[model samples]
Target: MKKHIFKLLAFSLVALLAIGAQADDGFFSREGKYNGEDRGKPVMPTQLNATWKQECSACHMAFPPGLLPATSWTKLMTGLDKHFGADASLSAAQASEISAFLTKNASNRWTAKTAPLRITEAAWFKAKHNEREVASNVWKRPAVKGPWNCSACHAGADSGDFNEHGVRIPK
Candidate 1:
Protein backbone atom coordinates (compact mmCIF):
# COMPACT_ATOMS: atom_id res chain seq x y z
CA MET A 1 0.00 0.00 0.00
CA LYS A 2 2.79 2.40 0.90
CA LYS A 3 4.60 1.68 -2.31
CA HIS A 4 1.51 2.22 -4.40
CA ILE A 5 0.79 5.44 -2.64
CA PHE A 6 4.32 6.68 -3.17
CA LYS A 7 4.18 5.81 -6.85
CA LEU A 8 0.88 7.56 -7.25
CA LEU A 9 2.24 10.58 -5.48
CA ALA A 10 5.31 10.66 -7.65
CA PHE A 11 3.21 10.48 -10.79
CA SER A 12 1.02 13.25 -9.47
CA LEU A 13 3.96 15.48 -8.64
CA VAL A 14 5.41 15.00 -12.10
CA ALA A 15 2.13 15.96 -13.67
CA LEU A 16 1.85 18.99 -11.42
CA LEU A 17 5.33 20.13 -12.23
CA ALA A 18 4.58 19.93 -15.93
CA ILE A 19 1.46 21.92 -15.35
CA GLY A 20 3.22 24.40 -13.07
CA ALA A 21 5.47 25.25 -15.96
CA GLN A 22 2.53 26.61 -17.83
CA ALA A 23 0.78 27.80 -14.72
CA ASP A 24 3.52 30.28 -13.80
CA ASP A 25 2.85 32.53 -16.73
CA GLY A 26 -0.47 33.63 -15.31
CA PHE A 27 -0.22 32.64 -11.66
CA PHE A 28 -0.26 36.23 -10.46
CA SER A 29 -3.62 37.10 -11.96
CA ARG A 30 -5.51 34.33 -10.19
CA GLU A 31 -7.93 35.11 -7.36
CA GLY A 32 -5.91 34.15 -4.31
CA LYS A 33 -2.75 35.67 -5.63
CA TYR A 34 -2.06 38.57 -3.33
CA ASN A 35 -2.39 41.96 -4.97
CA GLY A 36 -0.43 43.86 -2.35
CA GLU A 37 -3.12 46.03 -0.73
CA ASP A 38 -5.07 46.43 2.52
CA ARG A 39 -2.44 44.70 4.58
CA GLY A 40 -0.07 47.06 6.35
CA LYS A 41 3.61 46.48 7.05
CA PRO A 42 4.89 43.32 8.76
CA VAL A 43 3.82 43.02 12.37
CA MET A 44 7.27 42.37 13.68
CA PRO A 45 8.79 45.72 14.58
CA THR A 46 11.89 45.95 12.38
CA GLN A 47 13.99 46.28 15.53
CA LEU A 48 13.19 42.71 16.51
CA ASN A 49 15.81 41.27 14.18
CA ALA A 50 17.63 39.61 17.06
CA THR A 51 14.59 37.54 17.97
CA TRP A 52 14.11 36.40 14.38
CA LYS A 53 17.68 35.16 14.12
CA GLN A 54 17.58 33.39 17.45
CA GLU A 55 14.34 31.60 16.53
CA CYS A 56 13.51 31.29 12.83
CA SER A 57 16.91 31.40 11.13
CA ALA A 58 17.89 27.91 12.29
CA CYS A 59 15.23 26.17 10.26
CA HIS A 60 14.08 27.03 6.77
CA MET A 61 15.79 30.34 6.09
CA ALA A 62 14.10 33.36 7.61
CA PHE A 63 10.98 34.01 5.57
CA PRO A 64 11.16 36.78 3.03
CA PRO A 65 9.65 39.90 4.56
CA GLY A 66 7.00 40.01 1.85
CA LEU A 67 5.68 36.47 2.21
CA LEU A 68 3.30 36.13 5.15
CA PRO A 69 1.08 38.38 7.21
CA ALA A 70 2.23 39.30 10.70
CA THR A 71 -0.58 37.19 12.10
CA SER A 72 0.33 34.15 10.02
CA TRP A 73 3.93 34.30 11.14
CA THR A 74 2.74 34.54 14.70
CA LYS A 75 0.58 31.47 14.17
CA LEU A 76 3.32 29.54 12.41
CA MET A 77 5.98 30.28 15.02
CA THR A 78 3.66 29.32 17.82
CA GLY A 79 3.13 26.09 15.95
CA LEU A 80 6.62 25.13 14.88
CA ASP A 81 7.69 21.41 14.68
CA LYS A 82 4.09 20.87 13.81
CA HIS A 83 5.58 23.02 11.04
CA PHE A 84 5.37 21.50 7.57
CA GLY A 85 8.15 18.88 7.74
CA ALA A 86 10.73 19.51 10.45
CA ASP A 87 10.70 19.75 14.20
CA ALA A 88 11.84 23.16 15.48
CA SER A 89 11.72 22.93 19.21
CA LEU A 90 11.97 26.13 21.21
CA SER A 91 12.10 26.96 24.87
CA ALA A 92 9.23 29.05 26.19
CA ALA A 93 11.35 32.16 26.37
CA GLN A 94 12.64 31.72 22.84
CA ALA A 95 9.15 31.09 21.55
CA SER A 96 7.89 34.27 23.10
CA GLU A 97 10.62 36.37 21.59
CA ILE A 98 10.22 34.89 18.14
CA SER A 99 6.50 35.24 18.20
CA ALA A 100 6.81 38.93 18.94
CA PHE A 101 9.26 39.38 16.13
CA LEU A 102 7.18 37.50 13.55
CA THR A 103 3.94 39.25 14.36
CA LYS A 104 5.74 42.44 13.47
CA ASN A 105 7.05 41.23 10.10
CA ALA A 106 4.49 38.70 8.86
CA SER A 107 2.32 38.57 5.70
CA ASN A 108 -1.10 39.06 7.24
CA ARG A 109 -0.01 42.53 8.20
CA TRP A 110 1.17 43.14 4.67
CA THR A 111 -1.10 43.59 1.66
CA ALA A 112 -0.75 40.10 0.26
CA LYS A 113 1.51 37.11 0.04
CA THR A 114 4.64 38.99 -0.82
CA ALA A 115 7.66 37.29 -2.31
CA PRO A 116 6.00 33.93 -1.71
CA LEU A 117 7.84 30.81 -2.79
CA ARG A 118 4.72 28.74 -3.32
CA ILE A 119 1.08 29.40 -4.01
CA THR A 120 -0.67 28.93 -0.66
CA GLU A 121 -4.25 28.46 0.56
CA ALA A 122 -6.83 29.34 -2.08
CA ALA A 123 -4.19 30.29 -4.60
CA TRP A 124 -2.73 26.84 -4.11
CA PHE A 125 -5.79 25.08 -5.44
CA LYS A 126 -5.91 27.32 -8.44
CA ALA A 127 -2.26 26.71 -9.18
CA LYS A 128 -2.70 22.99 -8.76
CA HIS A 129 -5.73 23.05 -10.99
CA ASN A 130 -6.86 19.56 -9.89
CA GLU A 131 -3.47 18.06 -9.07
CA ARG A 132 -3.55 18.38 -5.29
CA GLU A 133 -3.29 15.21 -3.22
CA VAL A 134 -0.45 13.73 -5.23
CA ALA A 135 1.70 16.82 -5.20
CA SER A 136 1.11 17.26 -1.49
CA ASN A 137 2.13 13.67 -0.79
CA VAL A 138 5.13 13.97 -3.03
CA TRP A 139 6.19 17.01 -1.02
CA LYS A 140 6.07 14.77 2.01
CA ARG A 141 8.41 12.33 0.32
CA PRO A 142 12.15 12.17 1.02
CA ALA A 143 13.02 13.05 -2.56
CA VAL A 144 11.07 16.29 -2.63
CA LYS A 145 12.22 17.27 0.87
CA GLY A 146 9.13 19.06 2.11
CA PRO A 147 7.01 21.70 0.43
CA TRP A 148 9.05 24.73 1.45
CA ASN A 149 12.48 23.53 0.46
CA CYS A 150 12.08 26.01 -2.33
CA SER A 151 15.83 26.47 -2.38
CA ALA A 152 16.33 23.00 -3.88
CA CYS A 153 15.04 24.02 -7.29
CA HIS A 154 14.56 27.76 -7.13
CA ALA A 155 17.68 29.77 -7.89
CA GLY A 156 18.87 32.25 -5.23
CA ALA A 157 16.94 30.46 -2.50
CA ASP A 158 19.84 30.91 -0.12
CA SER A 159 19.66 34.62 -0.59
CA GLY A 160 16.80 34.48 1.89
CA ASP A 161 14.23 35.38 -0.74
CA PHE A 162 12.11 34.10 -3.65
CA ASN A 163 11.01 35.62 -6.94
CA GLU A 164 9.15 34.24 -9.94
CA HIS A 165 12.06 34.79 -12.29
CA GLY A 166 14.26 32.49 -10.25
CA VAL A 167 12.06 29.42 -10.55
CA ARG A 168 13.33 26.31 -12.33
CA ILE A 169 12.15 22.72 -12.31
CA PRO A 170 13.28 19.45 -13.81
CA LYS A 171 11.76 18.44 -17.08
Candidate 2:
Protein backbone atom coordinates (compact mmCIF):
# COMPACT_ATOMS: atom_id res chain seq x y z
CA MET A 1 0.00 0.00 0.00
CA LYS A 2 2.79 2.41 0.76
CA LYS A 3 4.51 1.72 -2.55
CA HIS A 4 1.28 2.22 -4.46
CA ILE A 5 0.60 5.45 -2.62
CA PHE A 6 4.04 6.73 -3.47
CA LYS A 7 3.56 5.90 -7.14
CA LEU A 8 0.24 7.66 -7.21
CA LEU A 9 1.71 10.72 -5.57
CA ALA A 10 4.52 10.85 -8.06
CA PHE A 11 2.23 10.59 -11.03
CA SER A 12 -0.06 13.23 -9.66
CA LEU A 13 2.80 15.59 -9.08
CA VAL A 14 4.01 15.27 -12.64
CA ALA A 15 0.53 15.79 -13.98
CA LEU A 16 0.00 18.92 -11.97
CA LEU A 17 3.32 20.34 -13.03
CA ALA A 18 2.61 19.73 -16.71
CA ILE A 19 -0.77 21.42 -16.50
CA GLY A 20 -0.32 24.00 -13.79
CA ALA A 21 2.68 25.41 -15.60
CA GLN A 22 0.44 26.98 -18.21
CA ALA A 23 -1.94 28.40 -15.63
CA ASP A 24 -0.64 31.84 -16.44
CA ASP A 25 -2.41 34.30 -18.71
CA GLY A 26 -2.90 33.96 -22.46
CA PHE A 27 0.70 34.16 -23.62
CA PHE A 28 3.75 32.24 -22.40
CA SER A 29 3.91 29.33 -19.97
CA ARG A 30 6.21 29.14 -16.97
CA GLU A 31 9.92 29.19 -17.63
CA GLY A 32 11.68 25.87 -17.25
CA LYS A 33 14.42 25.44 -14.67
CA TYR A 34 17.11 25.26 -17.33
CA ASN A 35 16.09 26.65 -20.68
CA GLY A 36 14.83 30.23 -20.70
CA GLU A 37 11.55 30.57 -22.60
CA ASP A 38 13.02 32.80 -25.28
CA ARG A 39 15.89 30.45 -25.98
CA GLY A 40 13.51 27.65 -26.92
CA LYS A 41 12.09 29.75 -29.74
CA PRO A 42 11.72 27.77 -32.99
CA VAL A 43 12.75 29.04 -36.38
CA MET A 44 14.25 27.56 -39.53
CA PRO A 45 14.28 27.42 -43.29
CA THR A 46 11.70 25.52 -45.33
CA GLN A 47 13.94 22.82 -46.83
CA LEU A 48 15.03 21.21 -43.59
CA ASN A 49 11.64 20.70 -41.96
CA ALA A 50 10.84 17.40 -43.63
CA THR A 51 14.20 15.87 -42.87
CA TRP A 52 14.79 17.41 -39.45
CA LYS A 53 13.32 14.58 -37.40
CA GLN A 54 14.99 11.79 -39.38
CA GLU A 55 18.35 13.42 -39.92
CA CYS A 56 18.80 15.54 -36.82
CA SER A 57 17.46 13.11 -34.26
CA ALA A 58 19.93 10.44 -35.33
CA CYS A 59 22.52 11.66 -32.84
CA HIS A 60 21.18 14.75 -31.15
CA MET A 61 18.24 14.57 -28.89
CA ALA A 62 15.20 15.86 -30.73
CA PHE A 63 15.35 19.61 -31.36
CA PRO A 64 12.40 20.41 -29.22
CA PRO A 65 10.01 22.85 -30.95
CA GLY A 66 11.64 25.40 -28.69
CA LEU A 67 15.28 25.56 -27.49
CA LEU A 68 16.94 28.35 -29.40
CA PRO A 69 16.21 31.71 -30.92
CA ALA A 70 14.82 31.64 -34.46
CA THR A 71 17.96 33.23 -35.84
CA SER A 72 20.06 30.83 -33.78
CA TRP A 73 18.17 27.86 -35.14
CA THR A 74 18.68 29.13 -38.65
CA LYS A 75 22.37 29.46 -38.02
CA LEU A 76 22.53 26.07 -36.35
CA MET A 77 20.59 24.36 -39.13
CA THR A 78 22.72 25.96 -41.82
CA GLY A 79 25.69 24.52 -40.04
CA LEU A 80 24.21 21.14 -39.25
CA ASP A 81 27.00 19.08 -40.75
CA LYS A 82 29.36 20.62 -38.24
CA HIS A 83 27.09 20.06 -35.26
CA PHE A 84 29.04 20.37 -31.99
CA GLY A 85 30.10 16.73 -31.51
CA ALA A 86 28.83 15.02 -34.68
CA ASP A 87 28.87 15.47 -38.42
CA ALA A 88 25.30 15.54 -39.73
CA SER A 89 26.11 16.25 -43.33
CA LEU A 90 23.13 16.59 -45.59
CA SER A 91 22.41 17.54 -49.16
CA ALA A 92 21.77 21.14 -50.11
CA ALA A 93 18.02 20.72 -50.67
CA GLN A 94 17.32 18.98 -47.37
CA ALA A 95 19.38 21.44 -45.39
CA SER A 96 17.63 24.46 -46.86
CA GLU A 97 14.16 23.36 -45.82
CA ILE A 98 15.18 22.51 -42.31
CA SER A 99 16.78 25.88 -41.89
CA ALA A 100 13.60 27.69 -42.86
CA PHE A 101 11.37 25.94 -40.34
CA LEU A 102 13.76 26.31 -37.45
CA THR A 103 14.36 30.04 -37.85
CA LYS A 104 10.64 30.69 -37.82
CA ASN A 105 10.02 29.01 -34.45
CA ALA A 106 13.19 29.78 -32.49
CA SER A 107 13.60 31.82 -29.29
CA ASN A 108 14.97 35.20 -30.34
CA ARG A 109 11.85 36.22 -32.19
CA TRP A 110 9.60 35.50 -29.26
CA THR A 111 8.50 38.34 -26.95
CA ALA A 112 9.20 36.80 -23.54
CA LYS A 113 12.50 35.40 -22.32
CA THR A 114 13.35 32.38 -20.17
CA ALA A 115 16.60 30.92 -18.99
CA PRO A 116 17.30 27.31 -17.93
CA LEU A 117 19.95 25.96 -15.62
CA ARG A 118 22.81 24.37 -17.50
CA ILE A 119 26.55 23.96 -17.13
CA THR A 120 27.36 24.89 -20.70
CA GLU A 121 28.37 28.10 -22.45
CA ALA A 122 24.87 29.00 -23.65
CA ALA A 123 23.68 32.20 -21.96
CA TRP A 124 20.80 30.58 -20.17
CA PHE A 125 22.86 27.51 -19.44
CA LYS A 126 25.59 29.55 -17.86
CA ALA A 127 23.34 31.96 -16.00
CA LYS A 128 21.13 29.25 -14.62
CA HIS A 129 24.12 27.32 -13.30
CA ASN A 130 26.38 30.22 -12.36
CA GLU A 131 26.72 28.97 -8.78
CA ARG A 132 27.86 25.45 -9.67
CA GLU A 133 31.45 24.44 -10.29
CA VAL A 134 32.60 24.54 -13.90
CA ALA A 135 33.61 20.86 -13.74
CA SER A 136 30.44 19.48 -12.19
CA ASN A 137 29.08 16.74 -14.36
CA VAL A 138 26.20 16.15 -12.02
CA TRP A 139 24.23 17.81 -14.80
CA LYS A 140 25.82 15.50 -17.34
CA ARG A 141 25.59 12.13 -15.62
CA PRO A 142 24.47 9.40 -18.03
CA ALA A 143 21.32 8.64 -16.08
CA VAL A 144 20.54 12.35 -15.85
CA LYS A 145 21.29 12.85 -19.52
CA GLY A 146 19.05 10.11 -20.91
CA PRO A 147 15.89 10.51 -18.85
CA TRP A 148 16.02 14.06 -17.49
CA ASN A 149 16.94 15.35 -20.89
CA CYS A 150 17.10 19.18 -20.96
CA SER A 151 13.52 19.57 -22.10
CA ALA A 152 12.19 17.17 -19.51
CA CYS A 153 14.01 18.78 -16.60
CA HIS A 154 13.36 22.26 -17.95
CA ALA A 155 9.67 21.93 -18.51
CA GLY A 156 8.26 23.91 -21.47
CA ALA A 157 11.77 24.22 -22.79
CA ASP A 158 10.53 23.35 -26.23
CA SER A 159 8.28 26.40 -26.01
CA GLY A 160 10.72 28.79 -24.34
CA ASP A 161 9.08 29.21 -20.92
CA PHE A 162 11.21 29.15 -17.75
CA ASN A 163 10.07 29.78 -14.22
CA GLU A 164 12.31 28.83 -11.28
CA HIS A 165 9.36 28.11 -9.05
CA GLY A 166 8.32 25.29 -11.35
CA VAL A 167 11.64 23.49 -11.29
CA ARG A 168 11.74 20.03 -9.73
CA ILE A 169 15.23 18.62 -10.14
CA PRO A 170 15.37 14.86 -9.81
CA LYS A 171 17.83 13.00 -7.60
Expressed as tens digits, the lDDT of each residue in 1-171 for candidate 2 is 999999999999976775664452113323534223434322222334547667766764456545555545665666666776568778998887767665555555334343222214445445454445223555666545743265545565433344566555555
Per-candidate local distance difference test = 0.53, 0.52
lDDT of 2 at 9: 100
Expressed as tens digits, the lDDT of each residue in 22-113 for candidate 1 is 34332344543434422233222345466666566676656554345555666666667676667886888888787776555554423444
- Compute each candidate's TM-score over C-alphas: 0.50, 0.51
Best by TM-score: 2
Off by over 4 Å in 2: 1-37, 40-50, 108-120, 132-135, 146-148, 151-171
Kindly give the number of clashing pairs for every candidate. Answer: 16, 48
